[model samples]
Target: MKKYLTQFKPFLVFISTFFAAYIIVTLLYKFYLNTFETNDVDGITNVVGKNVEQLMDLFNCDIKIHKSIANSWLEVWYNKKYLVRIVEGCNAVSVIILFVAFVLAFSGKLKTTLLYIVFGILFIYILNVVRIALLVVLLFYFPQYNHFLHGTFFPLIIYGAVFILWIIWVNKFSKYAK
Candidate 1:
């Protein structure tokens, strides 16, 4: 038993650190969310919606984002067509949290780790805004593919980017890297 424990010590450490970070960040986010009224959208989601609108506008696309009176989400409109809802999940905070957890688990030097995390979060946030704007435009053109685009394709794009980031961190920057 002692031999087995010794052999797996690194793995155990990684798991514990990852979960600790993930839980703490998630709980903090939940506490932030809880501060908002039931009918009001959280600040992060509101910022994401506004970023999406601005992104689309830069391309001369007709885009408008407004809070939904019927729910806590923001309504995204493209060319006066109701396209999609920008919900909390769409803000990519969860993805950022996941990324942070993994990075911490495989952490390098303090300065490197903190810098990587900051840049990684910024990249994910910007990617999410662009994703939403592109999704709105695509949905306007191909409403029939809404489920695939929203449920599968967009998720794949975001998660795939995060996965790639994780790989880069583990291979290039992590303390465990060879």
Candidate 2:
């Protein structure tokens, strides 16, 4: 037991520290938001969806905001259909990648590290918002195949984008499998 602990303590410490920082930061952000009556979209997403909503409105498109049943969160509606969910908030797929990058960097795990996780998170966030906006529009423009677009095509494209970003980061910065 002692030998194992001695061998793995550093790895454990690094993982724990990285996870602690990520969780604390995320929770504190959530706590701060909880103290206010402001909408989640504005507070969280920096109003990207809100801005898009206005653009859609200007086109005489049918998009609106609907209050969520659970979180009181606002959702984007188009032609009375739920267009964007969870308000202006983006999804977390890219965020997890960011976390992995950050923890590895902090722990000195990855090799050839260059661009840190902050940039990765920001890049992914912007891409996610853009993805949502595009998906919403595609739903309206190509109504007949909305399911295929949403369930398969767009996901492949957006996730593919994130994958490419990760690959670039790994090849350029992180020296994995080496």
Candidate 3:
């Protein structure tokens, strides 16, 4: 029994840490939503929507983003035409939570781990915002490929980036690497 338990210790530790972090972060996020006055748009969703609008404007795309009439989403318009809806799910906080949990489960030195988590979250957030912005433009130009782009290609890009980042951390910075 002792030998069996010892053999599974590392797996247990990783699963425990990942679940602990994920639950804590998800609970905190839920608390934030329950407590805060999100008005029509939640903070993270609003920020992502605004970032997408700003990026589009930078490219002279003439974008407009405002609260959707359907639900808690931001309706994005390009050249005054409805393009896409930016929902709370598009904000990428959940992705960041997953990324953080994985990193914590595979942690290295304390300071390095902390720094990597912060930067990794930032990178994912920025990439998601950009991804949303570009997706809008792509859908506008190529509405024929809507299902393929939104359902398959874009998800692959975001999750693929996360996977690459995980590979880098596991190989370069994780204690498991040593």
lDDT per residue (tens digit) for residues 38-118 in model 3: 446788888998888888788888889999765778898887789889887899999899999999999999999999999
- TM-scores for every predicted model: 0.98, 0.59, 0.94
RMSD of each: 0.7, 5.2, 1.5
What local lDDT does model 2 show for residue 30? 69
Candidate 2 local lDDT, 1-178, one digit each (tens): 9999899986776577667766776776667667766543435544555655666677787877555656646677878777556443355443554455454634333343334565666766666666776778787668788789877887787667667766665565653323
Inter-residue clash pairs, candidate 1 = none
Q: How high is the lDDT of residue 125 in model 2?
A: 65
Candidate order, lDDT descending: 1, 3, 2
Regions more than 4 Å wrong, model 3? 36-39
**What Cα-based lDDT does every candidate model obtain?**
0.94, 0.62, 0.89
Which candidate do you rate higher for lDDT, 1 or 3? 1
Best by TM-score: 1
As for candidate 3, its clashing pairs are none
